[model samples]
Target: MATLMLQGTGSDVGKSVLVAGLCRALSNRGLRVMPFKPQNMSNNAAVTSDGGEIGRAQALQAIAARVELHSDMNPVLLKPQADRQSQLIVHGKVRGILGSSNFREARRNLLPQVMESYYRLSKQCDIVMVEGAGSPAEINLREGDIANMGFARVANVPVVLVGDIDRGGVIAAIAGTKMVIDSADSAMIHGFIINKFRGDPALFEDGYQSIEQISGWRGYGIVPWLSDAVRLPSEDAVILEKPVSSAKKRQIIACPILPRIANFDDLDPLKLEPEVELVMVPPGTPIPAEAALIILPGSKATIADMSAIRDQGWDIDMLSHHRRGGAIWGICGGYQMLGRTISDPHGIEGPIRDIAGLGLLDIATELAPLKELKAVRGTAFDEVLEGYEMHVGITSGADCKRPFALLQRQRPEGAISADGLVIGTYCHGFLGSTALRRAMLQRLRINSDGRDYVASVDAALDNIASELERYVDIDGLLRIAAGAGQ
Candidate 1:
């Protein structure tokens, strides 16, 4: 099998974006390439065509490669549940909740499954470019690490080390990572790429040579920062904090940044509206006094993050906003937080066990046995909405009296308060659709020329792919993957 691995010096070093670009670039050369990540730790997940949950980044990569997306691309996924604890998902199904100490043991048992998925994809694609999860220098995690060097070493794939120059310490990061990796894993790296470089590329010529000498690796390329990346939907919640100018009407939408943020993509549709400004106020950021709406984003750690929201003075801020006639919307975990109480008897989120919510709505939530996962079509605020559900909470109480959306041939999915100002839903990505966005904007007396969000992103990807085709040695990359070039 012809395979290559893209490992990073550290997290958020542009590995995910680079993989997407390379996938598009290689596919443009008339070769079929598939993106794979042996294991991933992300709350931002996408539903597969066959009805499975995989990392959102891998889904983007699949689209870039022009291939059908599948859960096999990411065999293992960990959704954070509490401090150093997470829900383990294997091949799209939940295994169980495990602490950080137990994940390694679980990973050892899941190796065969990982191999099964890898070889299956290997046989179906011309080339498989695998992306590693985090830094290889995390020596403390080296023994039980299945996502980085561990998987790369077993898969026998050559590696390309990608470093972010924008983060500074490009040379030190690359050199330090090399110094810490196992000898065998270090040897797998054939070359390195300097990513997210700003200013002139020639300015880094000397630095590149110095790095090459220190690490004894060849310089593959220096990739400049792509400014149009904002048009793309980001899977990482940490990267979604860029602020935009508020609409002329000054109608504001606020999102409480929960500890285990997940599936925040529900706001994408609202973001495109000219009359809407989506503001994410993390813990400690004071809520604006004149804000009209507050949104509570999805979180993996519902109970714990609810505590975090309470600690950040948001609890007080939200109450003040509500008293001022401001509207509040919640999704998934946030939906649960709107209720009077949340009972986590199983310790699914943390050691503290059960907790109370903001009580904005008259609902009460209990962590449930079965996770709801389905594509739902529904109605909310007189607008037809379509989204996917992925939550494990059963809600009840007076606020549950009004349904948020009409779904699946007459079933309603979500809660709408009597005043119609408070809304909560378990569905994520409900706003990415243009129809939904336009309707939301109209509610605020805002006018907008709706844009096709998905298409705009696809066009951006096409542009990046075209640019990469002109710059990279496409044929040489193919040959290298085929095990012909050194």
Candidate 2:
């Protein structure tokens, strides 16, 4: 099978999006294609069809390729907790927790596992598109690096380096990478692609040529900034720092940005609504009282994020908002924080202890060692909604009797307060369902335009694929994938 890996000059260089767009584009060309990432470090995760979890970006790429979600797509996922430690997931199962120092050593040992997944995928597909994490230029990290060049070298995969021109220094980022890396590693990269270019492409014609001349790598193409990307779920928390909606929107939906926010892209659909304004309230910024709904998103560390909210006075703000009859909705860890008490005897997150929750709901939760990962279908507000559950807590109390939704598993999930103003669920992506979105807007007395969010995402993927056809050198990329390129 032909294999091509896309590595970025640095993080957030549009490598993931490019890989996704290319996957869809190649699939459109009637080629059996698959996306692979040997290792990924992100809290934004998605439940796979295999009843396991993988990085959300890989999940999105699978959708783009029109394939089933598989944990083998991302064999090694590192979800950062705190204290320089991360929860390591190996082949869709939790292996254990490892600190920074130990993780470096552990990663080398996991190479065989990574290769096994890669080989399995390669055998099933005509072309396997691999995505590299961070930059391969970090010589320090190159020793035990299963993420980029190391994986490329082992798999004998051709690499195409990508640099974000919008970030500036596109020339140095590409050429510097060539200068810093070892000769063998440098030889793996056949060509380079400049991403996120704005304005006239002619302006950068000289610059692109300079990169080609300096690095002796062929110029693939330059991709312009895609506005349609907003419709797709972003996999990084760095995107949460900026405002997601315009201030002029009539209805305001505020979400407090926790320190270790996970799966914050659940708010992406809300940003698409014209009348709805979505705001991410950072630390020290109080939740707006005028907000019609305050959504508490999932967190990698519930206790620590809860403490951060208290320290920022956001807990008081949420209480005040609740008193004003504003709606409060929590997902996963946020749901745990909304309960009366949260106990972690095994210290799954941190030190063994119990902490008081917001007490908005009568329920209590105990963090467990076993995590639940499932793709679920359910009904909320009498509207059909589908989402996935990925958490490690068991909640129970009198309030659970008023479940927020009836799941497909013939059981009630989540809880609703007696006042009907508080709702908490462990499911993520519930709002992406059109029926649920409309019902939620109606509850807030806002007009619904009846948009199909799933269709919008599909259309966005098609648009990205179309753009890739126009901007990227598909023929050259295909040749590179076939191991026939310089």
Candidate 3:
């Protein structure tokens, strides 16, 4: 089938990024490669070229592979809406909301769809690099698991376990995981890869030998950490809050830390500015008043997180800043929170609750039954804004009064108050475009040097992939794909 699996020791061990690099590596070798994830759980998603929504990581991988994204690449997506409830997207469409416990039991019913998607990708690509979610040794969830060992075992695909040495316990994490996996699933593991290695590769000689001796899995390679990875657009919402320093003017920008953060790459383009620093302030941290601008980023649980905003004291800070004539901008879920009131009639976020918003803009929002998921092209802040639409609320009345951006057919989408201090939009990538980013920052009295955000990110991926290709044995991976010993 020309398919291989990339399994990780645990979550956020760099499996997704490695898969992206390998996909680019293989594609650079003149082979058509595609990225696949049997199952994924994240609220941050991407709209495909075909107008379907899939995990954001898979979308980035597809971009790295230089292939068109499709829903078949990620057939099962679980976007958590609450602690125990999630909105399930099967084969690219919403099926409904299910509690986490019920979702686990219902996952088995999607196995057929999983296999079908796998086989379809197999037929179309020269090689399909599959990403396994979390750890394969999660024995408790392994019974109903379709992401790691379960998918690998069903497809009989060889696996390369990626362990992050930077996280510490590299030896224990890799060996312990191997020791606990079922015999059949263990047999599918072709080799082990030590990723994010900081010191000399030779320094890990003993550690490499020990992993082989203990797990009986060959050591494929030891990849050093890529420092310039800032060029690659991040899809993991967890890492979106890292510090971003801009070199253009040496000023910092902060985004209001939302609890249920999603699709946070909206700030990535700003990172390209050499003089700007993008700071994602989570709850408890004080928002600096000297910052050039404050953005209220997207979120999954708007009402719940809005409550978090008030609890974290940001609501008070925002109010204090607004009176001082500071600029406040919000996108998507953040846009909903800028209104006067938000009502959850369908109880999508909570039990049909209604809450007061920041009141920056004179508007009201109501959570709706239908979700909006599609790629959108519009003009915002005097620039062409290209991004996907994903939300479950409708803003109405005087709140939706001013139009911030013109969508297809020149329809106004969001609003800008008469004072111009507060602006809100449903668009996510408004800041990615140079014209839009410049316009918005100019309105805040901030000067910026333009940057080619997308090109710089793609170039970073290319450099990282080229470096990894030089160290890893490509022929060895092909042999494993052919069901042979490396």
Candidate 4:
């Protein structure tokens, strides 16, 4: 099988989107394709059909390829729980926590597992599209790096460097990358693509030529800003900081941005609604008092983020919102926080043995060593919905008798308060289901546009594929992929 790697000059330079678009473009041309990432660092994740989890980006790319998600798609996944500590996932299973002190050495030792996954994936498809993380320019941290050039060199995968022209200095960024990285690593990059370009391509002809002359690499193409991308779920947290909306007349659904927020993409469907505005409140901000619904999102560190929310006084704000009869809902770790207490005797999530919850629900939770990662179909709001459960705790109490959903397995899940204004559940991605989502929103007196979320995402993929076909040299990329294997 053929292979090619896409490495960006920096993170969030459109590498993930480009790889996904390329996968779709190739798939449309009747080639069986697979997406791989040597390592991925993100709290946003997707549950694979194989009972594992991979980065949300890889999951999107897998969808683009019309293939099932697999743990082999991302061998090394890191979910950061603190400033210097991350929960390490190796081959789709949690190995343990990894500290910054032992990160380099431990990561270097993971090369075998990375390669094993890559080789297994390569055997299943005509071509494997590998995505690199961060930048090879971070040479100081390049010693034991398995994310970028280190993986490329070992796999012998030819690279296509992608530079974000919208950030300016496109010429310097592409050329500077070559100047900084070692000669051996530089040789792996076969060409460069300037991404997120604005205006006419002819207008930047001179700048494009300068990049080619300085870097001695062919210019593949310039990609314009994709407007449809907003329809798709975002894997990077950087998007949370950007100014997204200004509409005030729409109904508001506010969610706090915890330090270790996981599965925040659950709000993407709401963002797509013209009459709904999903506000992500940053740290130190009050949860909007005017919000019609206050959603407590899943977190990698439940107790820590719960403590953080208290520090931000969001707990008080939420309590006030509840007293005002505003709807409040929690998912996973957030669900744990709605309970009377969260006990962690095994320390699965950290050192604290137990912590008091918001006490909105009568339930109590205890973190367990076993993590549940399963896709389930359930009935919520009197409509059937598909969602996945990815968490590590067991909750029980009186409120649970008033379950928010009943799964296909005849299991009662989630809880609802006596007043029916508060709710908690462990299911993620249920908001993507139109009927159920609409029903849930109807409770708050909001109107949904009745759009099919999955179809919209598929259409977005097709649009990106069409754009890539128009701008990028897909034929040349295929040739590069083939040549590398030969």
- The candidate scoring highest on lDDT is 4
Lowest summed lDDT window (length 10), candidate 4: 241-250
- Please estimate how well model 3 matches the true structure, expressed as its whole-model Cα lDDT: 0.83
Model 1 weakest 10-residue run by lDDT: 477-486
Can you tell me which runs of candidate 4 are displaced by over 4 Å? Answer: 246-249
- Candidate scoring better on lDDT of 3 and 4: 4
Candidate 4 TM-score to native: 0.99
Candidates 3 and 4 compared: the better one by TM-score is: 4
- Model 3 lDDT at residue 143: 81
Winner by TM-score between candidate 3 and candidate 2: 2
TM-scores of all candidate predictions against the true structure: 0.92, 0.98, 0.95, 0.99
Give the distance in Å from residue 143's predicted Cα in candidate 4 to where it truly belongs: 1.4
Distance from true location, Cα of 416 in model 4, Å: 0.6
What's the lDDT for residue 202 in model 2? 86
Clashing pairs in 1: 379-406
- Candidate 3 deviant stretches above 4 angstroms: 240-249, 484-486
C-alpha positional error of residue 480 in candidate 1 after TM-score superposition, expressed in Å: 1.8
What is the C-alpha lDDT profile of model 2 across 1-486, one tens digit per residue? 788999999999988889899998999999888899999999999998888789989999999999999999999999998979999999998999989779789999999999999989988998999999999988889999999999998888999999999989999999999999999999899999999999888889999899999999999999999878878898988887755538668888899999889999888888778888888888778899899999999999999988988999999999999998889999999999999999999999989989999999999999999999998897998999899999999999988999988998768999999998999999899989987888988988977677777788889989999998998899989888897222
- RMSD to truth, every model: 2.6, 1.3, 2.1, 1.0
For candidate 1, the lDDT comes to 0.80
Per-residue lDDT of model 3, residues 226-306, tens digit only: 875666666667675555444445676778667688778788788766667787887788887777667888888999889
Cα error, residue 448 of model 3, in Å, equals 2.0
Candidate 4 lDDT tens digits, 1-486: 899999999998999999999999999999999999999999999899889999999999999999999999999999998889999999998999999899999999999999999999998999999999998888987988899999988888999999998888878888889999999999899998989987898899999898899999988899998887887788999998887865654888999999999999988888767778888999878888999999999999999988998999999999999999999999999999999999999988778589999999999999999999989898998998888999999999999999999997779999999999999999999999999999999999998888888899999999999999999888888888897754
Each prediction's number of clashing residue pairs:
1, 0, 13, 0
